[model samples]
Target: MPRQACKKGSHACDGVVRRNAEPIAYAHGFDWRPAYNCKQWFAEHSEQMTSDRGGMMKRYARPLRLLAITALSVFLGETLVMLLLPFLEPLPQHVKVLLDASLVTALVLPMLYYFLFRPMALYIGERDRTQKSLSKLSSAVEQTADAVVITGMDGVIEYVNPAFESYTGYTQVEALGQTPRILKSGKHNSQFYEALWKTILAGGVFRGELINKKKNGELFHAEHTITPLKDDSGSITHFVSVWKDITERRRAEEALQTFSQRVMDAQEAERRHIARELHDEMGQALTALSISLQTAEETAESPAAAEQLHQCLGFVERLLQQVRSLSLDLRPSMLDDLGLASALRWYVDSQGQRAGFIPQMELDSLKTRLPPELETAFFRIAQEAVTNVVRHAHARQVRVQLHRREQEMEMVISDDGCGFDAQGLQTRNARETSAGLLGMRERVLLLGGQIAIDSAPGRGTEIRVRVPVE
Candidate 1:
C-alpha cells in the first residue's frame, strides 16, 4: 500500500496519496500513479475494487477472490518449478526438459480454469436467473382468483398456488403430494372420473362441471378445464387444470328456471279454474233454459211447432253436456277436494261410463297422508294416463293400483287395450296421441317422481309412478 499527506488546513487534500504517474482529482484528494491509469490496474481489473457497497458484495466478492487466488497460484507454481530445475538439475536433456515443462504449464493451467471454475460460474448465473423467473411466476399465480393446479400424470398434486389455498382452505404444505380426489364431493361416481381420465389420456381436452368439497366440508361448484401436458414425444406427462368457482352463478340460473316454471304453472292453473267455472255455472244454466223452453212448447196446441221445439231442446241439451265435459277435462274439481286415490278412482269411473271401459281398482294399504301438491300431481298424472288409455287403447278392462311402501307412494295403471310400442313412442315426436303421455310425465317430474311405461303392440299398457314420501 502507498500513502501520502494532504496540504495543511485543506480538507479536500487531507490524507491522500500521490505516486509517479499523473495526478487526478478524486473526492478526497489528488493521486498520481500508473496503476490508476492502466486499464488492467486494481480498480479496472479487480471486481472487488469496483464493486458496489451493498448486500451484493457479500455474494460476489468471495467467488472473484477465489478466482484471483487460483490464477496467482498457477503462475507462481510454474515459475518456481522452472527456476528450481535450472539451479539443481544439470541433466543431459535439459533443453527438452524445459520445453516439456513449458508445454505442460500452458495446457494444464488453462484447462483447469476452463473446465472447473468457469463451468461453476456459469451454472450459478443460470440458476439465479431461473430462481428469479420462478419467483415472479409464482407471485402472479398466487394473486389470481382462478384456481390453478399442477398435477403429475398419476393425478397427484405437485403444486398449488396461494389462490388455491384461499379457495379450498388448504395450505400448500397440507395438500402437496396429495391426490386431487381430496376435493371430491362424492356427487359423481367412479364412472365419471374413469371417463374423464380416459379422454385426457387419449390426448383430448376435458371440460366439465365438478361439485367439490372444501376442507371444512362445504360444497362448492366449479367449471373446470383440464388440459393434458404432453412431452416432446406427445406422451402426457402431467395435467394442468384451471377452474373457476361458479356456485353462485349456477344457483342464480336455477332460480331463474324455477321462476319461469312457476309462471307457466300458474297460468295453467288459472285456465283450469276458468274452465271449471264455465262448466259448472254457465253450462247448468243453459241446460235449465233448454228444458223450460221444451216444457212450454209441449203445452202448446200446434203439433208441428212442438216437434220443432223438441228438436231444438234436444240439440241444446246435448250442447250443454258437451260444454260441461270440456270444462271438466280442462280442470278437475275432484282433485282438489279428494285425495289422490279418490280422485283417481273418480276419473277411472267417469272414463268407464263415457268410454264404456270399466276400470278395476286395487288400492290397498295407503294409510300415509301425502302433501297436497304431491297428491294433486299424482292425481293429474293418473287422470291423464287413464284418458290416454281410453282415447287410444280401446281396451275393455283397465286396472288402477295405489299402494304405499315404507318411504314411498306408488301408483300403477294398466289397461288391456290396443297398446302401441312403448319404446317407439318414447323416441317419436309428440302427436295428439302422445300429448297425454307428455303431460303425465311433466306432472310426475314436477313432483320429483319417476314414471315408467310398459307397452307393446298387442300387449297392454302399464304405467308405474313412484314418489318419495319424504
Candidate 2:
C-alpha cells in the first residue's frame, strides 16, 4: 500500500493523521480502503507519531454523524447491536467475530458513554419534555374562554391570556409588567380593591362583579375571581385571576326590567281608558233612560209600566256604582295624582272594611313621593301582599307601616290571622297561590330592593320590604 494517503501534506494526502482511525472508519458506515492507514504503517510504526484526538472527536462528532447518516441512507444506519436485533444468545461465528473486532467491544469508549454521556442525554430529554409541556400550557391559556391574568405578589402583571386582550382591548405586550390600575373604571372604591387584595393575599379566593375600562375608555362589567397560587412549600408566589365579561348579562337584565314595567303600565293605561269610556258612554245612556222613565211614569197609561221603570232606575244606579268601583280597582287615579301614601292609606282602609277592623297604621315621616317607577313597584308589591293577607291570613287584626330612614324606605305588613308555613310557599308553584307573591318579588328585585315574608303555622304572617331611596 502507498503511504501518500497517511502522509503529511503531499499531493495525494490532505493532512497527516497521527491518530487511531477505527472510530472514524466505523462512522463513515463503510470501509474507505485508505492506503498505509490504520493497521499498515500506523500500526507498524515504532516511533511516537500519534497525538490526542478526544477534543477533535467531540468537536467533529455532529458532522461525522450527519455524514454517517447520509452514507448509510439505504438501511437504518444503526450500530451492529441494532442489526443483530433478537439474535443475542448465540450469535453466528462471523457476526460474533465482527462484533468482537469493533471499537465498541475492543476500546474503552462504551464504558465512557455510560460514565459520561448518559447523564447529558437524559438531561436533554427532560429539558425537551419540559419545553413541550410549557408550550402546551401557554396555548391552553391563550385559547381558553375566560380571560386569564397572572400577576406577581406585588401585583405586577406577569402574564395574560388572549381572551383578556380581547376583553380589555389591550394586547399582551401592553399589559405586561403594568399594574392593573390601567384597567380601573373607578366604579369601585379603594376599599373594594383593598378587600380584594386582602382576601387573595391571605390565600383566599376573591370573587365579585366589577366595572372595568377598556382601552377605548368605554366601561363594561366583569365578573371575576382571583386565587392565590402557592409554591411547593406553601408560600404564595402569584395570583391567578379569571374574568368573564358580564356587560351583556347586565344589559339583558335591564331590558327585561324595562319590558316588565312597560307591560304593567300599558295594562293600567288600557284599563283607565276603558273605565272612562264605560263611565261616560254607559252613564249618559242610563241617565237619559232614567229621565225618560220619570216623564213616562208621570204620563203612564198604567201603574205597571211606572213600577217597572222605577225598578229599572234603581238597577241603573247600582250598575253605575259597580262600574266606578271596577274602574278604581283596575288603576286608582289617586295613585297617579296623590302619590304612594294616599294610595296606600286608601288600600289599607278598603281592606280594613272587609276584614272587619282597621289595621294598626303608622305612616309618620314617610316620603310622600318617589320616582314614578319606584312608586309603582312599591304600590304593586304592597297591593299583592295586602291581598295575600286578606285572602289567606284569616286573622281579625293587621298592621301596616311605611316610613323613610336614612338612605332607605321600608314597609311592613303583619297580620294576626291564621298563618301558614312561608317556607312551603317557596316549594309551591306560583300559580297555586291566588295572590301574586312571585310577581311582587320580581318587582322588588328589579328596583334593587329586598322582600321577605315570614310566617309559620298558627303564627301570623309578616311581609317586610326595604328599598334604597334616592
Candidate 3:
C-alpha cells in the first residue's frame, strides 16, 4: 500500500533538500521504494504523526465519539438489511448492493451528525457556560463589602452573604428562614413598618436609615436599599436588600447636631442676660429721672410747665413697658415658673393684645408641669408661631391648641388669614421674612419634635407641632 505524504519537509531532509521540495516517496509504486529506507522514514515521522493525531483526537473527542457511535449504529442496520437481502427474491446484485451501502453511509451519517449529535453537544456546552457565569456572579455578591440579603416573597430571609453575617453578627445558619423583623430594635412602632411594607409591595424601592439589633442584642444603624425582584410573569418573587453599616456616620452626625444646639442655646442665654440688663438697670434709671423731673415741675411756680412734665412722665412709662416686653420676649420667666401651658396662654394673650388680633387659647389634660427643657421649648415655639401670625398672617383671629396625648405633646396653631406659599417661603429671601417660622422649627426639632405646615395660595395656614413627651 502507498503511504500518504507529510505536508511539510521532514527535519532530516531540511539541509539536504531545498525549500518547497516534494517528498521522496511521492509517485512511488508499492514495491519501488526500498524496504529499509521506508522503515527508517516511518520510524522518524511516526512519532510526529502520532502526536498530531493524538492532539486532534483529544480536541474533538466528544463530537467524534458521538459521530462514531451513530455511524456504527447505521452500519449495523445496513448490514442487517444486507443479510436479509438474500431472503428477498428480487434483491440487487453485489455491485448495486455495494453502491447502496456507500450512499447510505455518505448521506445518512452526516445528516444525523449535523442535526442531532452536534446540536446536543452545543447545548451541553452552553449549559456548562451558563452555570459557570452564575457561579461567578454569586461569588462576587458574597464577597462584596455591602451586606446582601435575599428574602423570599413572604419577607423571610432565604439567603444572606458573608458580609451580612460579618456586619450583623448573625451567622448564615442563624439567619436562614428568619424574617427581617429579627433585626428590629423596636425603636419604631407598627406604623413605620406598615408604611415600609406598603411602599415595597407597591413595586417601589424603599430607602431609609434604620436602627437594627444584631445577633448579640447590640443595636447598630444601617442605610438600607430594598428592591423587589420579579419573575418572568412580573410577579414579585423575592426581595433583595443591600445595606451598609452606618452606625459611626449616624453617631458623628448626632454629635455635630448636639454641638450646634448647645451653641444656639448658649447664644440665647447671653441674649436673655443682656435684655435683662437693659430692662432692669437702664429702664429703672430712666424712670427715676422722669420722677425727678415731675417733682421739679411741681416745685416750680408755673402750671404750664407742670403739665408738660406729666406728659413726659407718661412717655417715659411707655418706654419702660416696651423695654420690659422686649426682655420677656428674649427669655420668659413665666415658662420656668408657670409651666408650658400657662406660658403658652400668656404669650398668646400678650401677642394678641400687641398685634390687635383676637386670640383663642385651648389646653386639654396638661395641668401638671413638664421637664424644664420641654417647657421652655414649647413656650418658645408658641411665642414664635404667634409672632409669625401677627407679623405676616394678616389675620383677624388666631387659635392655639395644646393637647397632651399618650407619650406625646401636640400643638396646633391656625389662623384665618391670607397665607403665603409654604414652598416659596423656604428660600433665602422668604427665610429672612419668615425667620420666626424657621426658628420655631429648629427649636422643636432640638426637642425631638416635628412640625408640619399646611398652607396654599389665598388660603389660611395651619401649623402642627408634635414632640415626644417622655
Q: What are the per-residue Cα lDDT tens digits for candidate 3 across 271-343?
A: 7797779778977888788789778777867888888887888888888788888878887777766777777
Which 10-residue window of candidate 3 scores lowest in summed lDDT? Answer: 26-35
Question: Candidate 1, residue 114: CA error in Å?
Answer: 38
Cα lDDT of model 2 by residue, 414-455, tens digit: 888788888987888878854487788877887788999898
Candidate 1 lDDT, tens digit per residue, 1-470? 35333345644532333444234432210011121233323333364334445447887876787677666766676676677666656566877577657756775667567756787899899999999999988888878889999887666788887878988999999988887878888898766876787777679998999999999999999998889897644656788888889999989976865775586478668867788778878887887889797787979689888888888888888888888777766666666666667767777898899899887998864565577667767777777788787778899999999888777789899998988888877777767446677767766665667999999998888999998886
Q: What is the lDDT of residue 237 in candidate 1?
A: 72
Going through the candidates in the order shown, the clash numbers are 0, 1, 0
Query: Model 2, stretches more than 4 Å misplaced?
Result: 1-140, 201-203, 230-236, 278-318, 366-368, 417-435, 455-458
Off by over 4 Å in 3: 1-140, 153-157, 170-209, 215-217, 234-236, 264-268, 300-315, 424-434
RMSD of 3: 25.6
Ranking of predictions according to lDDT: 3, 1, 2
User: lDDT for every model?
Assistant: 0.75, 0.74, 0.77
Of the two candidates 2 and 3, the one with more favorable TM-score, higher being better, is: 3
Model 1 whole-model lDDT (C-alpha atoms): 0.75
Q: Clashing residue pairs in candidate 2, if any?
A: 395-417
| Model 1 TM-score on a 0 to 1 scale | 0.52
